[model samples]
Target chain A: MREDRHVVSVRDIPETLDDSALIGHSLSEPETFAALFDRHADEIHRYAARRLGPELAEDVTAEVFLVAFRGRARYDRSWPDARPWLYGIATRVVSQHRRAERRRTHALSRMSVDRPATFDDRSADRVTAEQLQPRLARALTRLSAAERDLLLLVAWADLTYEDAALALGVPVGTVRSRLHRLRAKVRRALGGNDPFAEEPQHG
Target chain B: MDDEIRQFAEGRPPAPAYRPEARARARELLLAEARGGGRFRLPRFGWQAVAAFGVTVALVGGVAAALSGRPQEHLAAAAGATQSAAVAEPPAGDLEPRPGQFILVESDTMYGSMTMGRNGEESRHLYRTHRKIWQSVDGSADGLLLIEGREPRPWPGQRELPKDAEGRQSSLWTTLAACPGAPHRSDYTYLSTLPTDPAALRERLYTAADEKDVDRDERAFGAAGDLVRETYLPKAQRDALFEAVKGIPGTQVAEGVEDSAGRKGVALGRTAGGTLTQLIFDPATHMFLGERQTVVDERAGQAPEGSVVALTAQLKVSVADRLPDEAATAEPGGGCPSSAVPPTEQPTPAATLSPPENVTEGPEPAVTGTMTATPAAPPAVKRSPSESAPAVPESGVAATETVPAPPVAPTETAPEPAAPGAGS
Candidate 1:
């Protein structure tokens, strides 16, 4: 009986598991789509808040999923993971509200002198993040939009460069080149030993 | 370098949140669209049947007219007036063809939309562009173009490849040979023929790059001259066009009329080998303005192939040049002024296809001024929901809710005093 139930549950899943399929199913059935909303809404909201701050994030995060729902038909389904697809949509959604994003970035950069670097009791990571925020902000401002998207998607969203390329509709070669240029500039800004000279291994 | 940047930039912050109301509105609109059929779906079977019946009636009427052969006078009238620019130009239906060498420009817009499965979750893109074209008296051609804003990539046409070159498909080689003109940063020209010998063509291209003393017009002429001398013409189609225009007796001075671009020019239309052909020319200057020859296939459902159109001077001529040169130079074989343009800058003509403030489709007003505000823009871009729809019911309801309260307050107070006493 248990084995039968397990098979039934697995059968209920989509024949093809992909970004387009995940979103496509939701669009077809609103109640079913609410499950997706429950799954991704919080994370998407958090991401928007970090990029554009609380006020704009609320609008953009909602808009991203809504637009994704509308355009689900055109989504290429060959890739199984929907995360990169979401990131791509989010990138455009964020780019649309760039003025708001810039304002948020600028506000974060201009930290008050007495501001504490921790949420709750300070951790070492928090302290480093705070210290790095200003200089990193300046360096980010210097990069082109394409370069910024490539570098930051990998950084914040935990996407591989190949995934980032799919999100940006660019060649993998372009993503790699842009990331390289971005890394050198960022490293110089951080005044760090060349940490990136060590290559990353990918399967 | 790319890997290093990606590695170095790892572990940054996340993005922000979305507004609840905006999200709600999007959900509402999407639901409504889903309830209504998708905007671009084909008509139902009943509608198609009605359309077929209507077409039958129209065809019968057309056949009657064909049997009567009443349009011969119109043709004769046009031919009679073809004799003279020195003579006063005739009224409508005058078909005076001029043998003048004039450059022309033409632009075409094509749109493709598809919905694969049910639920109507579709995406659509509108592509609009203009081409600069130059044609000699003998039908030699050159075309230059700049794709405007947000133009999707083009569909590939039929291509022949050698066995060794099967995997190594080079856009650079095909684009270079497609058009007659030099590939300037501001423009890319399309060619119907490639030079018979590739090595010879490359050598000439290299040598021509050094010939900077030539004026824009002369350079264009030289390119066209070289193309005729060097490029292999597929003898079949060129011969047909030549044969079609060859026999019509007496020189016809093409009168000028307004073309699709709103520019006044003389025009001629002909059908050859399943191609609908039209040529526009400026009567005053005897300059060729544009040519559109499209072979449309209703069966294929879109303009798949065998359709051709050219609009331009030898080089691209734009209403305004907004894109940076580097953006243009990114194109293969782009002859951007290398000395003036920095190497890092890639020429991208993002502004080329931007819609003008006021748009016209042959005097029929498609979109009015107020309707074209932020609401008409694609939701992917920078427009707020409120800005898109300025009028909301909330403010209107609030105004009515406020108006009745103050006057009713005093009368309600007297009743309120009695109500507390009675209850006690």
Candidate 2:
């Protein structure tokens, strides 16, 4: 009878369970959802802040998690990770503030960067990037909201092509083609010079 | 990652880390939702909803009056008043405004306002304003709104007054334009045409243009409060409005609730998403006194439980013979800079007034002004016996237990209606 007992103590449930298991358990124990929030809230907040400045990001981040929690029952448990689903929801949430995002990018484009003396490769790279920010922001403003979303999910959120496709609910091929076209447009915007073209290539 | 993409990421301005307080607040709301039997309820009194409502109202026209109500002690009194065969009369005097006269309404109102700092921190405070408005008895002429900003009250958990709240003593006068097709809903001419039967009025209240995300019952209850708070209604219409309020499911009465000015009254309140909006009435005369909104659950509203986030005291409503000199000189589009106008009293754009979509929706609530006023024959004043009968039993238990008992309810049903309303 002691060997047959099936009750698991709270301590016995490992914290390392993947998101799918946590979300599955949360159906019976709703507090289990908080662990998911703790795992993803920082990255979600950072992604939202990068798009719409910090002030509006606070609201967007909160809304994203609430919407995710409410719709958690419908989540596909086949996926082991929750990042794609969260980023997908985040894409929609951030889209609601399209005007704010445009305003932010346009504001950045008009700002002049003051150059500083560089001491190392990292600082030099940073200085070069700062110099290119004006054109980069302007190029971002010119992209359609969909293109901007896909570009940023890969470029900023660091999603792989497959994950970007998952986040945007598109076929992976579409991600590759869109990125190819967007890179060309951004390269053109940078006066046909790629900032990293001169760097030593690494495998 | 592509080299160009890598540079793009590196060039991005650094985002500030999420504030711990904000994170905790969001967590608390989530936990509360989980504890609430795992059903998702739209956040009650969410800062975003309130801020959005304010912005929507501002874009549509100037600041509309805040929504209000109180709970159970008043239900018993209201029921007692309804039993008698005698027609209910206005408490002070004849509230009917004669044709060509203006209806002057004065009130002290406090509502929550939120502002974000440059660093992305949000601060909330209760902005108090003294508002005086005069509208023509008929909706033919423009109205005037004179709002004077008062000292703002600190919201619960506020450390110090935000810079946005400082030196807010300036007053501004804005002209409430009565465009060719847009009639003011609260004007006596429009209100007099409302259904006098409680059930019909209640139905009409429900069918108004729905505010996105607000529960229908809560919207109707808030609409009823708006109709009575800053406008004068005839005795019969006022009586019908009060009676109709009982038909709204989830209404609870609070025996003794105080308005902002310290006047004691019985309050009829309905709780939704954790905030209880109460409409207070003079217990003796049943005259609508004011409105109060209290956070009954801290988790949903992100405030201390029992915190009164909004309050209004109706000081006076009387007939006036003429407009002030300022009104005479006020142009249709120009009077005061918008910054000078209290955030609540910005002039409404004409598009919100007479849109075809609004006309089809139904009569607009006096505050949100989402519908057009249709002229109907005055409703019959005679109340049938059944209509006058108490809708809810005068049982003490029903009143006490219907909703979360407001934190202010005294143990001994104190004879004096003076229960200090919480967190005002």
Candidate 3:
């Protein structure tokens, strides 16, 4: 037990020390750990901003990677891709700051009218993306927090509902239903009979 | 629905990385905690205690993949199999396809545990116990139901329910018809949406039904436990469950696979967690078969996965007996209870103020060190002798005996005695 305590101690360093050994180095190596943060900080920052807005985004992003690094000891080594795990943590962090998130989204929607194209600046190949911002924001506000989270994670993060479920820690069934309800609501809001406007429409 | 909304939000590419210096500081903070020298420590769980918790109900039942766009025929087959396993034999060709789809459902059945000890018994025993039934109808849900087994009687802590005319329990139909999205009507017109508060939303549904002078909200309130509990789970946990299932190792859309219902559907890949989740749908109707979630939690740093948690169920769009009521098509004026009616019809927005009034006031104000506020305290302190003694040490110690009033009058009636060494 004494030896085990020392071993655990070496594994449990603070932010001042480097714990990143990638399975085979002295846990004291800080440079190894810096590589992980350098890789994820900015993308996580952008994701935080997109979900929570610019002001709260930076802090939330920092907190996210900070958490990820702290919890890295518990990570399953068999899993190589860390994006899903990071996303899962980010989802909760975003939720904790929900009020801030809502206010930001509301503000963004209001501004979307001026820069409608920026929200969905898909290539000129698609005409609908250009014209849909005002109507989309209105539709966006009608959705429940859960609904909006599921939708936006997919659009911006490009995660499938299944991947999203992992990021969200929810069953896929919930994801599908939220999407369905949200799509229906948006269609009703927009009065857009264009089948493609809704999800999984059979043309 | 979630997928559709997400598709619309299409995210941008990753942002540029932060400079190396910032990354180094963050690395140090995490390592300190890792070394156990910082403020954080990982929570400890006894291996036996973990085993005793049984499989997490949600993790086990989440084996059912939430399906989309499946044939009705396949759904009937799969649902029939699952139901038959739990209950009686299912109906034949009851597997026939139908319209609409299964939106979502609660995945797990959580059983509460209890430890009982005899008066003189040295050892207490814990047992696996059953509570309520919860299932999600579709992938986007957490617990499909909030309540289980028999209508709950009202209690001190009981949540309020909506009721119908004749003082009966109300349902989804009666409440939604006249309410115009009563729960969320406010944001709806501007964004055309509904409110998210379950209680407020319930009231809106009730108000809509009451427009006909009916008491739907009241009736629903009576049976609310059944309505909401039918899908109860903490909102945050539910969200987490969605994220977890999505992260299961190796989860991907399979081109062609047969689900429990034997429907030809796309497969979702597995995850490192060893949970297999897939979506099966009918090409013809786009109806959904419930999800199949297979979960395994391998012992950390151990070679073998320890246990298997499997939960599967089916969700279909069934005709709710209570629907086609006013909630489906609430025409104007059909439900306005006399008191609630006037404000609703005039096209003016009705103010739905429903917060409790008796918010408690805070404790007496703390004293600030300002000289201007000192005079006000003396009079208040003097009136209450008991308080003044402890409050004003300077004045109390100076006056040994009771003192008379210090009066200065231009037209003097009498010379007031200076009590307690006043003359000295």
**CAPRI tier for the interface of model 3:** incorrect
* Model 3 lDDT per residue over B27-85, tens place: 44333323222111111111110001000111112122333323323333644555423
Could you report the DockQ of all the candidates, in the order they appear?
Answer: 0.09, 0.16, 0.07
lDDT of 1: 0.36
Number of the predicted model whose TM-score against the real structure is largest: 2
Task: Kindly indicate the candidate among 1 and 3 with the higher DockQ.
Answer: 1
Candidate 1 vs candidate 2: which has greater TM-score?
2
lDDT of candidate 3 at residue B371, scale 0 to 100: 8
Ranking by TM-score: 2, 1, 3
How high is the lDDT of residue B40 in model 2?
A: 12
Per-model chain A TM: 0.76, 0.81, 0.67
Q: Which stretches of candidate 1 lie over 4 Å from their true place?
A: A1-18, A26-31, A112-114, A117-124, A191-203, B1-11, B14-424
Relative to the unseen true structure, what is the Cα RMSD of model 1?
Answer: 26.8
lDDT tens digits, residue span B72-150, model 1: 2232243244323212221111111011111122232222212122343322222223222222211211112233322
Stretches of candidate 2 exceeding 4 Å from the true structure: A1-203, B1-92, B157-159, B180-184, B209-212, B328-424
